[model samples]
Target: MTEVKKQKPGNSVLGLFKEIFNWYPSSYPAAERKLLFKLDLSILIFACLCFFVKFLDQTNISNAYVSGLKEDFALNGNELNYFNVCYYVAYVIFQVPGMLLMSRPQLSRWLLPTLEVLWGICTFAQSRVTNVHQLYALRFLVGMLEAPVFAGTHFILGSWYSGPELFKRAGTWFICNPLGSMISGYLQSAAYTNLSGVGGMEGWRWLFIIDGIFTLPVALLGFIVFPGVPDSPKPFYFTSDDIALARARLARAKIRKPGPLNLDVFKRSLARWHIWIFVLCYICMIIGGYPTSYMNLWLKAEGFSVVQINQLPTVTYAINILASWLGTTLATIYPSWTIYTGATGGMVFSGICMIVWNIPKALKFVAWYVFGVSGCLSPILYSTVNTVVKGDSEERALIMGSMMTFGYSFNIWVPLLLFPTAGPNGAPRWRIGWPVAMTFHILLWAGFITSLLLHRRE
Candidate 1:
């Protein structure tokens, strides 16, 4: 039997620096190193860009709404929330089925990019919406088309990279979200200033139109650039030897090119404790991480102008990118359940700040800044789940889809239920929102500890 190697406790500070710069060297052969570089360039780049576009489109709606879409469409009384709900409804409905279908042999290559193009079109269509109902329908259509891509990309990442290599790649991929957030802020601000009424449209509408125009070419390139499922015929960039090395690495790790989806796959996956535990944990993640949404709305209510509203929340995205990198890097260096503890710390800080709203306005701003740091949790949590469920490709795919679906399922109602459209003194005051976020963060931390115990006991 092969012996399982244990990780060494390298100096934490030094290790963190290495992870920060991606300077730690592995002992792979020259051939494997070449293959890894090639994969990182060809696969990871496009995947990250696709993720950037995905998030840009999703969050731009909020930017557009606050900038102008709300007034133009006569939206009122939580219709903004309803627009988000519509997206989640379609997203949740299509997620698992889409992943299952995309998992079939030879389908992902064309299918995934095709869906990206379609969604890009749907996003552009949002520029044409005339009413709340029209906005809802288009967002729903975009959701359905966008559903499978994120989870599907996670599955593909697992296929190409082993556990240690995967998290950083996942971090690189997931950082696109913050990058997108930052870009959305800049884009909306620019559009509002430069593009407003340029050609007979509101600046917010131009945000959708211009962003959609940028998305089409990337989706087209994705068709040519995305590496297909691991076990498929090698791409033109990969020689036969590189293909052999790729499969051998995965095989040595016992990562299979999962066979056809079947009843047994579902049965085995769903019956596992990790699946349910991780799913519930992710649901809490979605709920606990809800405070960031109010950043812009609060600023708006506080009488920030259109540009200020779009530009200020970007501070959170900046903090988010830094926090995400630190969290994922620490996880890569240490490889422990303790990685999640960082997220819990940020949440606790945010909760305390919110709970004590009577503090000076400067402290309230600090609380909001720290609130952005919690963005790290989702990527780190995803990495942890991928590390635990590495053995089965089908199960990994299903679990990822299930986790996202379940999280989003609750998101369909949780925000409206927990967050008021308007809060006191132009602040979300969150009376209930902050406390609920705190409770979920506590629960999520406990779940991590519980999962750690269960894993160790096993």
Candidate 2:
């Protein structure tokens, strides 16, 4: 008899580690593993960088306001809220159109980077605003450009990755939001400390300039690295065989290729409960998490130094990053419903703590830190949407867009009313904001339950 060698067990310790951490299952062929590695290196890196810079640019306004924009503009009223409203309005207007445009592979690669460049220009322009009106105009433009980045990137990721591979990747990309915010905190602190008066500009102005500068290189890299949805033009880095493998994998997972976008696609998407339910759920999740945005303001009002105000909130972002990583890892291993349940419970607990509002300072800090659990929910929810709508590419794109559009549409008026900076209810414990946020968190839990029931029925 010929000598035979025994193969190692597939469930070896190293294989388990690979599946847990690398998203690489031992069951995959060597070729498939290689393909995933390449996709991760190129597509995931670009997506993470793009999202990271987007948040950096977006959150810088808050940092700038705290650093000096508030004083320099004499914004004692609700000008900051108005700035956000301008952005939100523009964001809502462009959100669906941008996602629809991104569905066409020909446009996505160019559209993403071009929009990035435009927004970078607009972000840089914010550095020179003489009045709030000018800043408002730039904010609108930046919002319009940035609206597509989140939903569109998710759409692209959903197109390329299967369900088993998606959550961890999505979670990794989603964490960049807090990572960007975390870095922005440190950056603003540094800018204020070192560059406050350089060239007769306020430190806040330098913050925008640096943020704008940071955006351009990443945008340029997108052109080189962004592989459009696998159906789009083949990327330079991917061999034809690689492209074939990608399409094959998605097909094997039963993910449909892009369908033509027309009235029926819209009709079908709108008629389905998926869009509405997900939209409502997303809106509640976002509104419920809104209180964390006021952390810096609260710290400032509590008589903290500017450095402390800027640096302290970073702890929340750090918690957010950790929560996202752990939550997504567990999600990959556990039942999908459990992820939402845990997130909803954590957020509800935080919401209750905020509504109580008279807790010890340390307990208050704990509430804010616990609130970071909200960071993980977005990836889980969006990944669920991707998996649920995998059969219809157009519907997936539309639902993603609608989720973002309707979710943000609330911000246009909600912040003005609940989280206002003027009138009787202002920042630093806007008495109404926490209570309202708590109510929304409760609603989010209901939505989670409804979603679970619906999924089971289907």
Candidate 3:
């Protein structure tokens, strides 16, 4: 007869607290806690900073658009939309290749930092663009460099943390997106006030310059301190025993060290339900989530000052962080419930808000709020993908890359095709786009249900 292990009662207050935070699993030894503290301090800190800066760099373009880039470069008539799409096209093209290279053990140490530095340089060069073509070229380069970092970092986090630990950690890491936006808004406000006309650069140009200059030092630090995966030599903070424990824990969890890219892994991953279902879920999530750039665009058209436009979006980001924290915390406790609740609930609320947006100015702001908050689905979706493919390193990498690749691939054209920026005579504000996005959100909800059913069946 098979032995049935008894489940522990998680009723103790201390136990409940730890479980809620995903801190210090009760089974951990004192030494394990010490090691984890070190890992969290060194690895998580750098990873979060890298992601924070990357997003800040990415979103600064939107800020620049409002500040002065559009006027300075003579941008009119779909050029801004095209510029946005160019980044994603490069992203779709380069993400998988970048991940392939980053997964190599020999290149793992240097690839991320090198890419960060290069992208930072590319971002800085944006300040100097004289025309739309120069802006497009630079955005593509920036996108290419940024392609692998998000998914690559997520994969690394998965490699280090166990299944239960992964969601909250990913939440904390992903929260940096909102945090970055908040910080960038403030930074842009400061730059526009203080740096305008300095060195003949517009405040928006100064924003790019300052953002780029800040990135290189971080790249240097990441190269020095960020721990690679367990398969590599132990980081200086980790003892040999800590390394052994790390490997053993992952081994017991069936996590595999990544191997070189090959046909067999691709064939096998394509055959798996988890990869396809979750990746499809991801594509829907991207389509259904709030449009970041549109919020600023709307505010700009509503006759808000540049600073008001910059600052208002931070409120959206604030609400986003709360929703994200709530969703991830609930997911840590109940994965299925959080998954269903976030996808279905957020979509319904956002769809209604978008549909009824014109009733009041307050309603429009509320629609944007709900849309931003709905971004909680992003990390939940990513964590689901990470957990589903945890044990196979190559498959995990391929799936992660493919998930982003296809998601961005859709982004390259779908928004352009479906969400027209203007009607005849250059009228602004795509109110029609909101309902279109809401319609897609309904489709996304269906996709989530199908994915859940598929996952449950497996």
Task: State every prediction's TM-score relative to the real structure.
Answer: 0.94, 0.95, 0.92
**lDDT, model 1, position 24:** 32
Which candidate model has the greater TM-score, 2 or 3?
Answer: 2
Compared with the true structure, all predictions reach lDDT values of: 0.79, 0.84, 0.75
Model 2 stretches astray by more than 4 angstroms: 1-19
Provide backbone clash counts, one per model: 0, 0, 0
Ordered list by TM-score, greatest first: 2, 1, 3
Give the per-residue lDDT of model 2 (tens digit) for 362-410. 9988888788887778887888788778889989988889888988999
Worst 10 residues of 3 by lDDT: 1-10
Q: Who is ahead in TM-score, 1 or 3?
A: 1
lDDT of residue 411 for candidate 2? 86
Runs in model 3 deviating more than 4 A are 1-18, 290-293, 424-432
- Candidate 1 per-residue lDDT over residues 1-458, each given as its tens digit: 00122234456767556546652347677788898898998788888888899989988998998998878876667777788899999999999988776666577767778888998888888888777788889989989998998888877887878655776777778878888988998899999999999888889998888779878988888878777677655667888888888889888877777787889998999788988888888888889887675688878877889899888888888888877766666566554456677667877987988877788877777878877777667776676666667777788888888988999999999888787565352237777778888999899878767766776666
lDDT accuracy of residue 209 in candidate 1: 88
Task: Name the top TM-score candidate.
Answer: 2
